[model samples]
Target: MAAARSATLSHLISTNEPPSLFEVAQLRRCVQTLVPRARLLWAEYKGLEERLQLCRIVLSPTRRLPAEILIEIFSWADKKTLLSISLVCRSWNASFNVVSSKSLSTTTMRFISEDGIPCHKILSWLAKPVTGTKTLNIEHEVSYREIRCKCFKPANPCPWAAPDFLNLLAKNPTPAQMVLRLKFSSPNCLSRLVGGAGNSLLWNSLETLHLQLTGNWSGRASIYRNALDGLPKTLRNLRLKINNPKDRRQPPPIEVPEAPFNTLKSLGIECSWDSPLILSILRLCVDLDVLIVDESIGRHTWTESAAQVTLPKVHTLRVKCLYLHESEKIFPLLHLPALASLTIDGGEVPFADRNWVLARSLRPLGLLSPMPRICLRTLVVQSINGLDGDALWDIFSHLRFLRCLVLQRVPFEGAGFLENYRRRTEGGEHLLPALRMFELRDLDEKFDATSFLCFVKVHRHATTRRHEGGHERIQEDAPDGLRHISLRYGDCKESRKFEAVREELVSMVGALERDFGVVVQMTRG
Candidate 1:
């Protein structure tokens, strides 16, 4: 066997030309003659050489980075950078394709078409690779030229009229459930999109819809109604914002179907000057889990009777208005038995009003009810113009289950602002036993830091007393005990006051951490 192996090794080296069949046959015969260890070593050396070559290529600086790393770099880049990255090279182009496709998977397309329709190139780019976009926004701006041009030249197509674009959507049926948000400034463009001869049918697959009417909204209610009539059954969320400068000549109300959205869970509406239309929507979207109403669209009178209308089903409510008295009256009408969150902004309720009986009585009466006493877990109040400390204390004192409280742009200039806060934190008036998170924003320099520190100190002392007496001990850890404090100071141009305020805030945070072991985060804007 050893002699046979030696003969095979000699045959292998004896080939002058690359091995032919006969040479390979002779080498195999020789391998049968050699010991097993030499054969194994020869095979292993070939494998090592191949691996070393691969490693050199991988570690070479001139070699292109892996596709995954390139994609990450693109993700961190902005839109302009994304465009530039696409132009780099062939490998980069392929990498960009994969990265851009993934990035646009949840992308929102918002068109500002006041100047003109989005160029065809943009539409073509969107239709390619079919990246399954989840949201589409189209905002059209109307101007004097656009109105006059369309009126005089009826034959000429308006720049924003893109039936072809809508058709493109039909061609590439993206699998993602989508949200279509459209803001239109031109009534002509709106009519073209949703009128009798419009393309409302293209929105058949939408899961969420948001519409904002900015220009000539009065006469366009018919157009909107027609558009809504074609809304897809899959829609689960809806938001409408209408701002009509010509609201003085009241437009005829659009008769919307009650509970227009059978599967809808969220609804938001912002109208400049009308409540009847808003009321119609509220009555129709009965099964909504979230509702938002913004009254800054325009000034209009709203009454308590409006809230009396039964809501189908709602678990969360957010209201932003300038009138607190009117808002208070409406709160009782909301049937939100399952509500776990409530937010109020710019309400007129006097912070010191001691009318707990009235306030409690106003809780919605019906199958839909506010959560049971202490069931509400989150409450936010912001931009309240007239509420003082006493009024806020009175309101907050009753919220036994509130775990988070946020105050923003709250006017604390009233006569007894500080005093009322002190009273609430004192032994007899202390409330919010379950409160774990507190946030304050847009506070003036003088009171921002000092007042906050004082409040924290009072609460800390009260908590210590509870622990000492063997009562239900308050937790020492934040959120668990009362964990986080967040403060956002509004931008003040006065540098001197800003500096002083910063110093005071630093001192306040230091004291809290040193004494109570609470975590505080401060943000300046």
Candidate 2:
């Protein structure tokens, strides 16, 4: 009788019913009555009973999913869903803690508050062992002096002062795969952070480092040199940018150690002037594969002086000059046997003087004698005032292996420039042999009818021939033939000229497609 009554109670509880509060109460009483001895059983196995009751209430097959499966489900969810899951119950909270620990491991902590309050919280969090942190980026704006004042205050002295964050880093070293960006308002703060008691600890595990120094502080290079002198030998990449004039005046000449970074592969530096100083620093990075020098100071003359410095092994070089004079000497530095790409900005070559720049620029290519066939595949030329289209065409003609050519503010002074361009290439069978992409920006309506037309016609005709080796050798009847042009026109201010230029460009593209069967795209600014 007791067994039959217990079975009956189980069936009633398991059924999917819209039971009232009274019905639920009566059901509980009936179940208890069915198994009076169950009270003793329940007391002896209280945890199991509670779990069984919870399973019936929340995990029954007729209802929803089981807790374990739901936990796994939440694990696959994104940050938003996980946050929502955390609010459900104690079980979910614990589950969330486990998943969150793993998910947040990839995030770097950034303290953005200007005041010291956030700094304290960050320090507290960092004080604990960060076993899972892969990268730590600290972009706090708090001044070191402020932190020192607060931590060293007498009223309620904190044992872990501002510098303790560094100390903690030193004491509990993270894995060597971590990357760090430590930006500071002043060099002094950077010095304090790196050279303090935590100095040895913080840099030991760093694999990549980026430092941006801003504000009124001077002597950043000195501070950086001192702070980074003993950095981990494992550093693979380094980027340094000093924007403040005060700081630029005092950049200490980098004292690169012999094989300073045994594993360093890339180095990028942006500052004003100090080209010789920069050259000296670059020599130390013997194994460097990429080098970017963006320093504009002291009239264009500085560039000429900078160009005199030699970089023999650099594979990639990007230079932005204020004046065009220095550009004349860039070719002589092409001792780089492996140079594959080159970019120059803010240089203007006159229509009459274009050949001079081209000849000198090509001198470096000549230096690679036995391998005179240098595989220089990409070239970017940006002119501030404008480049004479004829001179540009002449320049492109010489770069036999040039694959990409970009012209900024190319000057098309009416029919003269276009006629000169056409006259030079009229008899020549080929143009930019390896050129596949061409871009022209900041042009006027005249550019569309003359300069654009001449380029398309010359290259289109040349490419149709079988023997043509330049950009002109497009496959006959092939849809992918030579001309793929992007033209950008217009000034910042609005003008009626815009509509005229657009119409001209549309007509030019239509003619090219209809007459030459070439595709051209026009985009307006």
Candidate 3:
């Protein structure tokens, strides 16, 4: 055996033969003789090289992008793709946080024609707050768990109990803003949140608090009042809307949350203008800066408390109603000296003349006096009966700095503002002395074209201001020069019928362009 191995070792006859255990034992002993520290260093070097190569192949260039850029890139991605990217890692999860983070704004929602949806399921799901979410909007149609309402079945009253809301509030106490709009099938509804139970995080730190109730509001007035009072007092904006389908014959007592609405800066209420709730809120929200009233005057007889309410800081007031009679009543209470923008619209209300209200209520306020306190810039008025010319004059006389004027569905009566300006010229004072943009709409064949022409001529001249310091120095915004006059005639057929009148209007427009360098347009309303 020794002689045969000797021959194999020398490769004298080693074809188809394997090495013996003695050869393997010698190789093992050689490896065992290496230095321990050298082996460890070699192992580490190989491991690190492998890791670097793996990183080179798998690491994404997108990972090096800044978070803001990454977010923008992800924003353009589809929803499913965005979700997939979010699950990549914790940092990426945070980078593309869309609905999951503070970028989500407070929104309003409404669901119409919805049948039996499990209110508890929805409330429970919403109550499980989306982390870092800012506002939760439950627009409409919430119901109880396991209970279905077939809206098609008239026999099923689908009366949802109040306890479901309690369960939702109990489970998911909101830490951010939540817009709650409730419409109940019956007179009964959830009364209030649990008296003293909530997350440590205050819910009132929200940017806005909106509550709208549209069912049998009268029957559940106390319930709503309790809910509102129990709400947090840290809201910055509040919008309350109530719609009652029942006749105004037996109006219920107005109920709103008792305040120290200390943080509320903006308030919009769509209840009756004479609602006690509105008065109560006004008395509480002293720091309000924006107020919009879109309500009709109810049967509220002014009591002693009504005289004390005042909104001191409101600058923008927009009144939208079908009737101006309520506005007439509202104007007396709103002695807003700081008012800058006023919009009043009598939308589809018969016998609603907003100009009459303005003339009646504003005249005594020393409005448009030689030295006026209110510096109004924008005025928008709309009505059906057409504004009385004297009424328009009375309102315009009070405005010296008015820049934009929009009149809708209101015709010019008597002598126009320019005609009045021409007659009552005392030291270069023109009608709407600083007017820039004049927009009128929905004038029928009965509209006075001559009055409109006069309006354009006067406003174009007034738009160019002269300075005593320089020779013919125009105003800073003189380039516009009353070029933004837009008029819409309600009846295109009428304009076609009165071809001569249409040509006359076109001639006037052409004259404006040629002489004053102003562009005027007429369109069908």
Candidate 4:
């Protein structure tokens, strides 16, 4: 009977039909008798898990960053980046402040002045320790608007800008390259700046200084003199302007005082060479190896005393002569025994024009018998209108030691000379026998491309091949013909599919490389 009763209870528990009132009462009694502590423990465990999750939310990665570091991150963001950050959330927008450098050497800092901010403040930012800047260029000619800004209350915005700049150099870590370009400034600032130059820290570290002084030069020699005197001996390269005195009545300074810059290796004078100031500076540069003289418009001719300079150590000479006939006269004055490279650019009027003949350009070297030919191995002539075949030969024939020749901006009219030269290549007369590299730039399509191939064919690899003859042996020892020919021209030389001449030129260039191990490069402008 008891087993039957237990079976009936099991059936009732398993069945899905509605339980009777008696059965419900029985279930309730069973639940009331269950273990109370077990239920209590499960509820406690769930509560703890929820609290642990809340702790994790509080310790998120972003919350770990320190306050100062976060500010720095915001500071580094540029205006655009900051705006984007601001759009992301109100918090970031509120924190956005200013952005602020690390061997700033070789890196250029471009500072555009604004109305409210002073230039001194801008310079201070440049001198910041983290900048490590080795090159600094301050230019006032940014834009027309900046010049006309209204924040500058004084009649002169920065009349003292030049002097203040000098002061900044003294205080900041001296940079390797410093260029100051100002406009319409008084000479008095130069005087005041140099007066305090002894205190400038730049004297010890500055290697190259380029100063362009734009103003009237009346009787301001004392200011210029004082400034030039402050230049330290450590300066190796200098580019300065020493304009001729406005008063022609004032003769050249009776005694030229030599600046104490014996270590200078290069000097570029943008002043009138006629100024005694320039000549005296040259005398001080005993070790100057490279000299570039850029003449001002006032005067082209130099007095006899100013012209004569014996720069024996100078191996490279580059002069911009405005006058056509002045170069020849200038050469007698420069007894450059060690001159190995020469670059001459004829202003406006191409040197290849009728008046400026190749022979006339060289008249200065004194190409007579006992007077040895200029031992220039490298020569560069640019902006030549036209050089006839004979003129080109005259220039090349004298340069026995010629190794590299660069002709730039040479018009197509002159380029035909190369064809004439090849047709009349005299027997055993090797023009440019030692030539190793030839570069012709800025040529149009009219240029004789065929002459270039012929020149290479005759000259290439001829240097190493020994010919059994008296003076011919020397030519063999001379370096082989042109090793490199770089041609840079415009649209005319562009390769076309059906152009036979262009295709032939391409084939010729390829053959030279394959057969003679030469490098022929063609670049389109």
Candidate 5:
């Protein structure tokens, strides 16, 4: 047997013939087995090099500088640079602390690692007392384990229920504003963090709160019910956003607060809410000065007995998404007596639905009613489809006090709107006489630039002649002229036509700017 093995080894060592496939496979397997070990060695080598570089930095003569000089250098550095340099050595960390302690007005706490590991260091640091922090932002993003374990489905509590953080918040001077963003893993998680049972005085002095709640919260409206139970009276501005999950489960309704949030002056909602919840919230905001509704105003149905909500003090109202199917129910529910600025953004419409005019949906209710004559000063309408010439005239003729007008993606018929406007101005009518600024953006292929320029010339000529005799010829209520005019349109069909008439448009706009002192900004694709 020994002689056979020797013969085999000698043949394998000195054979001229190519090896079999089995031998090739064995060799590949051996190479694969060493890959991880090689990686480990490379990592160790890199670590050693880093440590040697750190040693060199420590032994350099720069380390011998006085603490006062170091403190001055640290003071000049920004927050990110100071943090990076603090990791070099203990003395640098000490210097950074000295600078940070004096100028730390904002503190942000991120309590979890990205890949699902618990940040034990941050958890331990949360136990220390923090003072003089005017703004505190705490955010916990979704973790890998939470995704892999499907923790959003089960009622399992997240591990980072830091009671110590709540205690620290209570110990410090009350922050003027606090922003909290977290996922609702379980009710207990929020109960221990900021709920009523967490700390009684946590929000006593807070004036502004921006709360963003996100999760697969299809059947968990109770989470919001418990979370918003104990708001501070000093909160004057509240921005709430709930990122809705893609599901069809109609979550159970949450109860509205018995008492109103009378101190809230500005409210912005960025998500869809049930009708009852939205109505309740608006009813409480009596002093709301600015209101922004980014998403749908209401998601569910409303009964016949649902009363209209009156926001008497809302001066600036922005309705970002106006679905034609739902606009009828939405517009009649609000009565804003003091509305001054309005933005109606009708987001992209399908090709098949090009004839749905907004005039049909804008009923004579709320601020659109003509009897009392809403003193709307600024009007912005964008991305609207099927707004014909007559409907456009109907909407614009009522705004006698409009100072700024912006229209985009409005495909009016031929030159109808502009012709009517010019004839009215020439006939000594007072429609939009107070207009000071007009902006047109992203016009469709149906736009008639020649007609528009004619209107502009007529309007400018009329207004410039108002003070020709060194005295005001027009009414005192009307403005002198249009101070600013911006025309921008870009699309496939319009781009071709724009190139054909680009030079003429530029020359005309320049003359308007030079003669009337009007700021004309014109661009075409």
Candidate 6:
């Protein structure tokens, strides 16, 4: 009888008529008793499903694939997906690490402090030997918030707050190239590397060193001098960048070393202020092959003795001056007898600062005169404020060997600037007669596209003109003509009218490429 009663209670809800209050209470009690058990069973079922999926993955046929095939497959994935794949299993992570290590020779590790504590990842990564790293870049940044945090007490300061990488670096093989970018609130943070005797031996195998010092420079001149003195003399290429913010305090006197860097092959300097100390350093690099000078201000005056320092072997020279007056100081000073490539960048003037200075002129570049038969094959000029096309043509007239010309954001004073190119096809001696590569970007709004088309037609006929005049032209002397042409227009109000002639430009470029074997790339705004 009890068994029958239990069976009837189980089927209490099977009846069509609604249950009475007592029957409904009995049903509620039954459900409450089974709820916890149902939850436990569902969780167990989910665990089993996960284990089954894992078993399938472990027994997959793809696991037998060769490392080369796996590497090729991984190469097709983006960085984010590849990283996720690396985290899936230990074997996959090891394989991906091998592939990545063989592909990249340069590795950059950045250390950012939080509440006066060093990053644990960097510390652990340093604990192991970093094999196959040709160039190691270490950037240490200390934020003011971290230094001023409540947890940062001077008496009980963090031991790893300041960078001390000597012990860590000794574990790895000596790298050929090292780049140190340091930004700190106090100068004492550099004590480990700068104030130690192991400084010279630390970089014994270094051939290239790029040091960028940026931070509070209230009294940093001496520290900078010491840092330079401590560097290894075996460096062949050295680049120094001084990113000092504007300060109201009196500028500290900088004393540069009198010793020359006789082994240096290339030297580059970028600074915000004018300093005679830079000239002193340039005078020392007598065997420099390439020189780059980029300065932002023209306030300091250079003495006559320090003005004309000649670099006899320099074949490539790049000068970037933000102010118009800076050109007067830079051009007349450099005498490059073997100059092959010259780049003059007149930096852009912000819209807000345009009121202070109207435009920077390229007329100063003309000051580098009497250069020994300009072997200049490449000339790049961009973002000049007030450029005169006629005067610029006069500058190009001298570069008989100019083969590649790149001009960008150069606002000309008058229209028909390209008319000068026609003179080359009309007759005798002309400007840029050997130009084989021409690139123009962000052309002026008022520039006439019809004139440009005419120029291209003349350029196409340039070499034939040289053969015409019944004069026996040497086979080697014949110009290559314009073989590569690249034109890009920006999307702005000034370029809308230029877009109207896009169809005509495309047709002309296509004909040039098909008929003359010229490489042409043209993009409409």
lDDT per residue for candidate 1 within 1-525, as digits (tens), equals: 568656756775787657668657867776676668787899999999999999997787745678888777778888888788789778778878877777665444444435455646445545555445545556555554543224113465654456666655555543465566776654344445543223344456667778776555434344445434545566788887766545465544555654346567898877655456665566667678898877643434554256454554676778765433334334455555566777766544345532332233224322113344326677776655555466566666666666888878765542354556566556466556667788887866655466656676667667566656866533443233456787776766576776777676687788788888777886666
Error of 1 at 97 (Å): 10
- What residue runs in model 4 are displaced by over 4 Å at the alpha carbon? 1-118, 124-135, 138-167, 176-188, 220-227, 245-257, 273-277, 296-308, 324-329, 350-361, 366-373, 412-419, 422-424, 461-470, 473-477, 491-502
What TM-score goes with each of the models?
0.62, 0.54, 0.57, 0.65, 0.60, 0.64
Decreasing lDDT order of the candidates: 5, 1, 6, 4, 3, 2
User: What digit string (tens of lDDT, one per residue) describes model 5 on residues 77-167?
Assistant: 9989998989988988888887776455455655443333233443443344444434545666556665322233346434433445454
* Leading candidate by lDDT: 5
- Cα lDDT tens digits, model 3, 372-422, are 767777888776455655656666866767778888866665246566666
**How well is each residue in 1-525 modelled by candidate 4, as lDDT tens digits?**
446546757988798788679767766665675557668888899999999988997787766666466667876666677677667544444454322232232333334434322456547545554433345544323345543222122243443344555566577655434533322233334444455555677645667766555434444344344445555555677777655444454433433345545677887876653545555566667788998866444443545555566777998878665554445444566677788887867655534453454455566765322345467778888666656666677667767677898888755333455555555554546566677898988766667777776667766644434232334443445665678888776646446622544566887888888988888887666
TM accuracy, model 2: 0.54
Clashing residue pairs in candidate 6 are: none
TM-score of 6: 0.64
Q: Kindly give the stretch of ten consecutive residues in candidate 1 with the minimal lDDT sum.
A: 359-368
* Clash-forming residue pairs, model 2: 170-201, 433-470, 433-471, 463-472, 463-473, 463-474
Candidate 5 versus truth, CA RMSD in Å, comes to 17.1
Better of 4 and 6 by lDDT: 6
Model 2 per-residue lDDT at 235: 72
The CA lDDT of each predicted structure is 0.60, 0.57, 0.59, 0.59, 0.63, 0.60
Candidate 6 has an lDDT of 0.60
Q: Which ten residues in a row have the lowest lDDT in candidate 5?
A: 147-156
**Model 4's TM-score against the true structure:** 0.65
Q: What's the lDDT for residue 126 in model 2?
A: 49
Report the error of model 4 at residue 474, Å. 4.2
- Kindly indicate the candidate among 2 and 4 with the higher lDDT: 4
